[model samples]
Target: MASVDLGKVLDKAWADKPLAEVLAAPVSALKGVSDRDGELLDEAFGVKTVADLADLKYVRWAQALAALDAAK
Candidate 1:
């Protein structure tokens, strides 16, 4: 499985965008997200981007994993 490159997903170009705007992007923009997982994320949690995946109120595991990944 490919790893999610959060740096690319959360690129400098996205820095000025609102959180909602950032999260509105397609999940495919996230490095490791397969089409199937992206669909599941959207269907199950409404997650469409890195920000959405990192939302603590929704997918806590994603947030935790993101943190762990960042630490590496």
Candidate 2:
């Protein structure tokens, strides 16, 4: 996949609409994410919205776990 400048798209969209609209938009619009990641995120975490990504406890835990694992 190609690189996507999500922040730029979001800034432009937010100027024309509500924050909810921007968040509800597809994750594909974001930068550097493959179709596979979107599908897996939707299935594994039910992360349909950008807002959902913020609330992912398992992801947060896993990130921390990876950091610890790498440090060892």
Who wins the lDDT comparison? 1
Q: Note the Cα lDDT for every prediction shown.
A: 0.69, 0.68
Candidate 1 versus truth, CA RMSD in Å, comes to 7.2
Which digits, one per residue and each the tens of the lDDT, describe model 1 over residues 28-51? 655566778879988988877766
The backbone clash count of each candidate, in order, is 0, 0
Instruction: Write down the TM-score of every candidate.
Output: 0.44, 0.51
> lDDT tens string, model 2, 1-72?
677554665544344556677667655445555567778889988987666775689878898999899999
On TM-score, the leading prediction is 2
Model 1 local distance difference test score: 0.69
